[model samples]
Target: MNNIATTLFLGKGYRVKKQVRKGNELRVYIEYEGKQRCPRCGSENLVKNGKDTKWRKKLHMSFGFFRVYLLFKRQRYKCKDCGKAFSQVIPILRKKERFTSFFKQAVIFWLIFFPFDLLSLLLGVSRRTLLKIAEEFISRVMIEELKDKERLVIGMDAHRFHRKDFALLLVELLSSLPFGLIQDKKKAFMDFLLSLPPRVREKIDEVVMDMTVRYRRAVEEILPHAKVVCDPFHLISYMNHQLMEEKRVIEVVKKRKIPGRVLRLGKEK
Candidate 1:
């Protein structure tokens, strides 16, 4: 029945041509009715050019005594307007990739229960492909995590890494996890902030930092909505700075260099 085919191959776009089973291995031959748009120019003017001579086999996971495989005859299309060749855009398949999107989901789901080697052997895919898939999955998950935050409290500060080398550290204060390390906090940090997804930027509730003029200016320009709260140590340090300056002025009024020690609190210190 088409219901079984639709469930196995992902949707109405596919029609079951044939189904073969030998022992525990199951092969489902199908045809795809996919989006006929040019991937290059987004034009719908396409013409059937040719079809692949061989069937492309994708390893879909196991289902109760049966290892499932999707066999598809890929069709090629030539864009009439762009004069370029393209393939049908399947929502469940990545362009020029062999496996379906469900296959990726299945692999990620089962990897928790299976060893990497066994999973790779069962899927008949190489170890390198598994690593690549895992990396892609982790990257997508991290991005989703970043985007899903309701409120993000950010902290940014410049620190001297070594003599004559300075760097900017940007982190989520709530999570204490650093997301960005920039060579310069000035323009680089602003650029990094700008590069963040607009949704993420909108969720920034506050930014904590020392009263670095450039840092403050960057925040004002990029994330003006976020509250800027100066760190406590910097606030005390600032008071000490002003006190030291007033002491220097008092010494100048006395018309002599002060011999007593002053509180060594300055930006350099």
Candidate 2:
């Protein structure tokens, strides 16, 4: 048995008197300790009241479900100022809640580590709920690392989006995090590049990109200090297949009974 799990349960309003595990099932016998003050006048003076009836509920664990045997030790407090006897509720656990604190922790961990559908299947929660938790975790921990940096080298590239062969991406090289997607029009890409700080813009040493003339023009227009270099692989591959492309287009136009010279010039153009 994990003592930390037992300690977490005790810290979360459950007094675990005994804990035993049989096979994969863990059984915990706990007593719910009521509040310390009098319920009527909120006085600290209290006397022992008789034990309430025992209650049984199921709690989820990592391995399987365990039956929690709860002995409600209700205390009747005699108010010194008002002279009234009343009961108080425990502060840690909410009223009528069946799942323990450890169980909640397990669910949160699962949501962070696994995908939404898998986490929903494991914890018996809806996928939407898991996605909400995942988004919360991302909001709490994941923030823009490129912002407020002394030097930021941003590289832009196009990635395949569905059937579209190219959707541009901006990468912050210092943090190795994706900054923004640059697609659609030239104006959008130019605007994104111009938004960086002047000092950070001056610190940019080099811009590595494929042999796209528009991308080169945009980088030169925005980042004046940066030297542009054509990424060799894209240039070489495009060059090697350029002739093959012209031949294939010419053959297609000839098969359609169009003039081959005009079609070849169009393919070359």
Candidate 3:
């Protein structure tokens, strides 16, 4: 059972000592698989001091519909080489954390498509916790992924989600993945582009955006080598507006000529 648990869920370097099931909740007692080594000195010459009797419960990925928790009693060891005492680190959970890495990742994945309130109820976690997980995950992803791009085709656009507020979104055109969002202001948009490294800015060859004069100016100033292309939607909207204005003028002229033509025909008859 320990071997199977280690292979399936608990991962290597952990052995399941015991398991208790109460309805849909599962409590698994786990410990390190090998001899306890001193973290400070990395030596096996250590004496058992005592057990950390604190209540440590780690929330893990669910098994089907059942909630799983890993309960562990951390072992304290006194190192002879370093003359210090330290507790064994749990590989599955970070220090001072209640959830496993895998569980946090799962929550982030669900949050991408589901509302926070709905996900919170489904996962039995508080809404605040779900939001924190998402924020940290997105921050890490953006820092790691966006900075290292060698070449890019970016797109910028503004959207109004509310009546009086607007947001500017920046996306990688090739992948259609959003990288940044800020208030729909010229300064905000310029600052966001300027925040990137010079190498990254140089690698941007093309930017697609609407015919906003501010957007065009900012891109030209920051990315001197990049070409800016106007999106088709803006062009079509402009053409439609001009055509409507011409049609109104033509209708007024025809209405004015019709009265004169009727009067002349009446006089001649």
Error of 2 at 72 (Å): 40
Tens digit per residue, CA lDDT, model 2, 93-166? 44455554455556667644775456556666554444333333332333245446767666667764335434
Candidate 2 lDDT at 240 equals 57
TM per model?
A: 0.49, 0.38, 0.54
What is the TM-score ranking, best to worst? 3, 1, 2
In model 3, pairs of residues that clash are none
Candidate 1 lDDT by residue in tens digits, 133-217: 7546654454456676789998877765345656676778887756665656477677778877899899998999998888888
Each candidate's number of clashing pairs is 0, 0, 0
- lDDT minimum window of 10 residues, candidate 1: 260-269
lDDT of residue 110 for candidate 2? 68
Give the distance in Å from residue 92's predicted Cα in candidate 2 to where it truly belongs: 26
Q: Which stretches of candidate 3 lie over 4 Å from their true place?
A: 3-8, 34-46, 62-66, 150-269
The better candidate by TM-score, 2 or 3, is: 3
lDDT (10s digit) by residue, model 3, range 1-269: 66757544666678777788989998887777557777767889988889977758888866445788888788787898898898877666788778988799899788678776677778887765765575456545663575677778988888653456666767888777677666688997788778776777878899999889988999999888999998788878876677666555655866542333434345412
Local distance difference test, each candidate: 0.75, 0.58, 0.75
User: Judged by TM-score, which candidate is best?
Assistant: 3
